[model samples]
Target: MKELEERIRREGAILSETVLKVDSFLNHQVDTELALATGREFARVFEGEKITKVLTIEASGIQFAMAAGIALGVPFVYAKKKKAVTQSDKVYVAPVHSFTRGETYQVSVDQRYLNAGDRVLIVDDFLATGAALVGLVDIVEESGAELVGVGCIIEKSFQEGRGLLEAKGVRIHSLARIAAMKPGEVQFIEESGNRQLIEERA
Candidate 1:
């Protein structure tokens, strides 16, 4: 965790007053060492929960989710951004609005990958407006799977993402939580419990 905190402080770029961009190592560019550590940390947190599968959205969430699945020795399932030819017809879908891309999209997964008796752990790279996670959670619930928890690499604490998930009684675990981000500076929130802060700005 210390290494992750240090990496964010060093390589992460504060894009304005809110967004902390880690594209150089996280969101875009891949950093395997850190990614593995992040996954391991997530596994450590939810180790004894009897997680049968890890659920995540496509693109960014896949990397960490895969790593976590490897560490936990569980299969990981990712919801596709769009329907593909290879996708199974029997699926569960959820619509999500992405604030960053200014678009709304649906993420879907094969119903066979998840079921009513499954215990799922949702993992993602970032938690901004909570839209992506919300959609993923919806899909999991549709399959009647028990959502054990949510694991995020970088959480924008100011966005009300955690509050939204907590209201549903889901436990949230983030390796790095940005408490505040200002022009040329970013602060990581170290405390837990319900507290609202600014997540991003133009």
Candidate 2:
């Protein structure tokens, strides 16, 4: 995950104490090679879990989830933010609040895609609010699937997201964990259990 940390340091925009904009590379315009590498990281981290399916919320989570499914040789499913006519009538639904969008969505997954027999790994782009992932976890519990763990591309370690997931006993692994951030300065938790500060130059 050093490469990912490096990318964030070099390309990510620190807008505020609570906002980091990675759209230039991570989201709006993705780096395919990096995305695949993240999948490999998730696969390697959860290699022994025997995952049967990958789940994610729609939009930002789709690519990473698909990459993970490909690495694990399984099909990926994404919960629709808006139920479509093609969406399943019988589904597991949960309320999700998007802090970035200032809105709430009732996300859902088709009953046919998940059940008691499947072991699931949930992947997503960021872990800040824990809202969407918590909703997905609720759906997984509703389906009776075994949740192996959650894999995140980046995590704001200072936030309540990690705490919320831990309270629910959900295991989480994030590639780049930000200990703190602000305009022109960011700190990341190193693998050695220490924080490394990076200062942006003008």
Candidate 3:
């Protein structure tokens, strides 16, 4: 987690008070070593949960979920943002609003990949609005699977995502939590109580 915090400080771009762009490393051009390390960290955090499968939304969440799956020795499933011809009719569906893209879309997962007997851990790239993640949780509930918890790579702590998920009694673990951010500056919620400065503007 320390390494992750360091990366954010060094490479993350503070676009605004609300948008912190980490595409250069975390999402777009990913660092394989960091991704695996994040998976191992999540595995360590949720060690005794007996997680059977890892779930995530497609695209950005896929890599982290796959990493988590490998660490946990389980398969991973991703919900498609749009229903495709290859998808079956018997799928769990939920609505999600993407604040970034300014649109709402239906996300779905095939029923065969999930069921009442499995325990699920949801993983994602960012935990900001909680929209996509909330949709995944709804699908998991509809499938009758046990919700283990959620693991996130980066979390905008100033946002309502964590609060919303917590209201549903979901446990969340985020490697890097941003307390606040603005152009050329960023602040992190220090889980270790050290309160380290991530970045500061000149």
Error of 3 at 44 (Å): 0.1
Predicted candidate 2 versus true structure: per-residue lDDT over 106-164, tens digit per residue = 99999999999999999999999899999999999999999999999999888888878
For model 2, what is the C-alpha lDDT against the true structure?
0.91
lDDT of 1: 0.86
* lDDT of each residue in 34-113, candidate 3, tens digit only: 99999999999999999999999989999999999999999999999988989899999999998988999999999999
Per-residue lDDT value at 122 in model 3:
99
**Candidate 2: residue pairs that collide:** none
For model 1 the local lDDT of residue 172 reads 90
Which model is ahead, 1 or 3, in terms of TM-score?
Answer: 3
- Model 1 Cα lDDT, one tens digit per residue, 1-202: 6788888888888878667778888878989988988889998889799999999988889899999998999999989999998888999989898887899987899999999999999999988788889888888889999999999998888777877887878889998887778866777776463343443321
Give the Å error, residue 81, model 1.
0.8
